[model samples]
Target: MPGYELINNSEKKAVNEIFDNKELFYNGKRVKKFEKEFARYIGSKYAVAVSSGTAAIKIALKCLGIKAGDEVITQSFTFIATLEAIVDVGATPIVINVDDSLNMDVKELEKHITKKTKAIIPVHMLGVAAEMSKINKIAKKFKIPVVDDNCEALGAKWGKDKLGIQSDICTWSFDNGKTITTGEGGMITTNNKDLSMLFREYRDHGHQNNPKFPRGRDTHRIYGFNFRTTEINAAIGIEQLKKLNFIVRENKKRYNIYKKELLKIKHLKLRRIPKANIPLCDCIIFSIDDLNKIKKILIELSKKNIITKNVPDAIEWHFAKYWDHIFKEQKISKQQLETKFLKSSYYLERSIAIPIFVKEELKQTTKKARELSQIIKSFV
Candidate 1:
């Protein structure tokens, strides 16, 4: 249920207005406006727009001064971008296994923490929140900062509050395949004024934006790189943000249809969700012990022109077990990677993640869910 499905003239007008203003990158008008609205929406004191989610994570790491020899812990069930960002920052990624929720297992989290562990990133994969309360408590005990990788769970909630705001720092993605889209962009949200100012400066090549002078005479607080996003993307993001509630509501309706039907199959176990969490509902995942049945259901869904989100369809990119080719220096062999994440593998290998669409009618969604359940029933 991405925001792209509900694209309308409002987005077009926003983009046109950007061009009509004749100030694309200099003024930071649309970017500022989008950042303000997004901060208000997420209940954060500040929001910084960046080139991508990876950049957001890297910036967070940079702001915290995480470097070589420092250890950053994340779950094995996340997109490789999280690992890549940690590696790019010269920090070693200590990947832990996920629980039934397909998120960072808090029980296993502290076992791997060492004196070098500087940051812990609990990724909310596929529109569900991680056990933030537990994760935060552990981080507090160790005095390690928590960075919630909320790229996939933008509109999700843990308890009554938004998922991202619970942690020390949260990073978000507005890429095309998310709850909302800015074609390709990201954001970093935090309540710390100093951290927010540092993020803003770092993303723009350390431009302090001194009021006394122009861009050419801008002052710098530190050496930085360019990770700035355009006003065009921010303009579209504003429009897309307006439709987020509608998308989430529609997604829940469709998700519940699948949930109700899938529950009829006694053998199929829905992915474990925390009682306090209300997921984004854009994707539904369920695990079946029989690998053969899982494969057959995927084949059947394909025949019906239905596509899965990420569990079995795009697992190579999402799961870290297949990323040994890139982590040679970290001594992560493919076999070792597989063995280390066996717990995560059990759920991921036997799961099917079906995507929910906002544009589809509820009746059609119900029919599809029934058909999907029937397909699973046949396999069972």
Candidate 2:
């Protein structure tokens, strides 16, 4: 879920747009406009709409010609969708450690590359940008393509440039929890014209226009899956895109409140923000040494009807060890990044995420934020 429910004029505008033009329910004008506007917003040559972020990644990988036995490198800490997309397309995920910024460590890229490494999928985790400059620099050296996973950090920037254009192809999500939601939808952005055409065809069951038939009559050019979303979602996306900057600014405002109050607390270690990147967050992440202490605090918070969630278990779905299903099917030649891995596990297990927006349950004010911080310090 999003940190809080958002009520805005843009949502009303979305409904109006959809209601005004409801005839073209599937693959219609709204979807087309949203794609164009989105492309322009991200400064990409093309944007292909898909059913979900997972579909966006899958299509990008497919267009890149990644197949079975191809190893794709990505962060060890990210949403499960990133890993599942690679596996769904018969590719292995070469999990790498996240640096101090809790993103894919660029320094470790060279050692992970081998003949089977087809692509690098660096995830922008929790609205934070992974070091794209160094990651792209290394990809350039090896002549490998990168599938930028900008699902969590859509409007977030890496230096002066937007996050989408740094890689060969990139994806953004519009599901419920993302920075901006389209109910259930995703977009694929790329500067490659030929690849964009393939993406267009791929999303619609490989249906390409045929001169052999008339308009609205097309034939399958290649085998493709139907991951097309509806016009209503696209319409919502169009409106949401307009307010992205405001939403990002509001989120940053709330994040700063948490930072100001939490900095005085002794036991918590906040995540490091990358130097050149502007990340938007709905929650503030902090790492602690004792999971048991956090559990006690979480329980106490729940008693007061304030929820503080435990960090995602890196050793669970996000970690490399928990992915036995993917690894079991892999070739024996796939080697480990390290024989012993605990640092990633340590951070994830002891980490905690405090929601910045708690809806009407907790008024979105600095005073309430300070209260939340005190409650945390009191528990520790």
Candidate 3:
């Protein structure tokens, strides 16, 4: 359900405005406006735009002073960028298994906590929100910060509020495949003023943005890096932000068509969604208890030219169990990695995630869902 599908004159006009001014660099006009709009939309005090979601995570970690010897805990089912950012900050990534919800298993969270544990990242994988209340409670008990990775679950909700605004620091991706697309960009949101300022400076190479001085004479508080986004990306994002509600609405309609049909098939367990979660409806996933049946369903789907989302198709990249090459650098053996993520493997292997397109016709979606159900029913 990428916003790229809805790209039209609105986005073209926004980009054109940037070209009209001939100011492509993000000198806090378009980028700052996008940040303000996004923060207001999510009900957060502040937002910092960055180069990409990976950069957002890295900047948040840096703002919190996470460094060597410190461990950051995240779910095994998350994208590798989560782990990559932790490692990039010179920290150890402590991966924990996900439960039926395909999110961090809160029950196993405390077991991984230690003196070195500096941050806990609970990723709202796919379209559903993780058990944020439970995860946040656990993190509070350990006195560790929580970085909500709402990259894949943008526009999703936990209880009454939006996903990213409820954590110590939240990160989002506006990449090509995301709910909204900016070609490639990211955002970090937080209520803490100090952390917000740090994120702003850290992403801009430590520039304090002093009103009295020019960019050449801007003072620095600490060493930073360039993670800035161009005005074109931000301008497109501003237009995309206006269409968020429409995207979510259409996604829900199509997702429900699939869900309604799938529910009629006995023994096909849908991915476990927590009661508090109001998903973005961008994707629907279900697990088949029989591995052979799962394979057959996939074959049938392939025959129809329908593609599954990340679950089985891109599991190798999304699941940490297959990241032995990365763990090898930390002296962790392949066997150890597999053993740690056994439960995650069990749930993810049997699952099939279908992408929901915002522009797809409902009748077509219903026809496909019925076809999909029949294929699964035949296997059962």
For candidate 1, the lDDT comes to: 0.91
Rank ordering of all candidates by lDDT, starting from the highest:
3, 1, 2
- TM-scores across all candidates? 0.98, 0.88, 0.99
Per-model lDDT: 0.91, 0.78, 0.91
Positional deviation of residue 175's Cα in model 1 after best superposition, in angstroms: 0.5
Model 3 has a clash total of: 0
lDDT of 1 by residue, 1-380 (tens): 47878888999999898778876665688899999999999999999999999899999999999999999999999989999999999999999999889999889998999999999999999999899999999999999999989999999988888889998899999888989999899999999999999999999999988889898999998877999999899999999999988888888988999999999997899988888899999989998999988888888889988888987888999999999965788887889988988999998989889999999988998998988888889999
Off by over 4 Å in 3: none
> What are the per-residue Cα lDDT tens digits for candidate 2 across 1-380?
24115646767777776667665457467888999999998999999999999999999998888899999998878777888889989888888877667788788889999999999999887777888888999999999999999988887887788877988999989998787788789999999999998998888888775669864678766778898877888878887787777677777777787788888888888887788887766678877677887777667656776655335523364556455556666542224423323556666666666665524233455876677677778867
- Candidate 3 per-residue lDDT, tens place, 54-167, comes to 999999999999998999999999999999999999999999999999999999999999999999999999988889888889888889999998999989987898888778
Let me know the TM-score candidate 2 reaches against the reference structure: 0.88
**Candidate 2 wrong stretches, greater than 4 Å:** 1-4, 7-13, 16-24, 210-221, 290-296, 313-321, 331-341, 358-363
Better candidate number, 2 or 3, judged by lDDT: 3
Better of 2 and 3 by TM-score: 3
